[model samples]
Target: MDAVERLRRLCIDDPVDDAADDPGWSDALDAHTVSLVRIGALIATDAPAASMRSVIDEAVTAGASLQEIVAVLEGLIGDVGLPRTVAAAPRIAAALGHGDDLVTDAEI
Candidate 1:
């Protein structure tokens, strides 16, 4: 199987813990890239707002800048569609500690 198929099996077919413990799949990429990709996956899937914190936190811990994180969200708009990206924005913002900004202003 190809990398995509392996990833699908690892993430969906295998047990969660097994997948987590196995670094073989992601070893090629740096932690920062992995974390950023996770952020993209979260956005693409329309994941729960509560789930955003840990994923964003991991991205930050892996040395991802706020710009990079936001870029992941923006970049996915083309692939995941505008609505999904927009829906994910609030969650991503909250995760990055700018949650209050959503409530405060309409500069755009």
Candidate 2:
């Protein structure tokens, strides 16, 4: 299967039989850009801390500096609006290892 098809299956918890053979997401975009874009999507969706964690790790592994990641969040504010950005901030921060305290406080 193509890489995008494999990724679609993985997203829904389906197993890709030949996932090991897939070239992965870096075929088009570089790993670093893809990782940062994933982070932005997570932020835009107000995704949970657990979901953000892995993507953030991937971003870091792909050589995304903390500043660039933070810039992704900041840059989306105008597009996504303050409320969504605010709601997502703590989860993203927690995923980045800022502390669960931020998440807890955000919940309150």
Query: Considering every candidate listed, which one attains the maximal TM-score?
Result: 1
Q: Name the best candidate (by lDDT).
A: 2
Q: Which ten residues in a row are the worst by lDDT in model 1?
A: 99-108
Tens digit per residue, CA lDDT, model 1, 26-79:
667899999988899988898987787899999899999988987898899899
**How do all models score by TM-score?**
0.76, 0.69
lDDT of 2 by residue, 1-108 (tens): 676777798899987765477546546789899998999899888887788898999999999998998899899999999898877777777777875655576452
Candidate 1 lDDT for residue 5: 61
lDDT of model 1 at position 72: 91
- Could you give me the TM-score of model 1 versus the true structure? 0.76
Against the reference, the lDDT scores of all candidates come to 0.81, 0.81
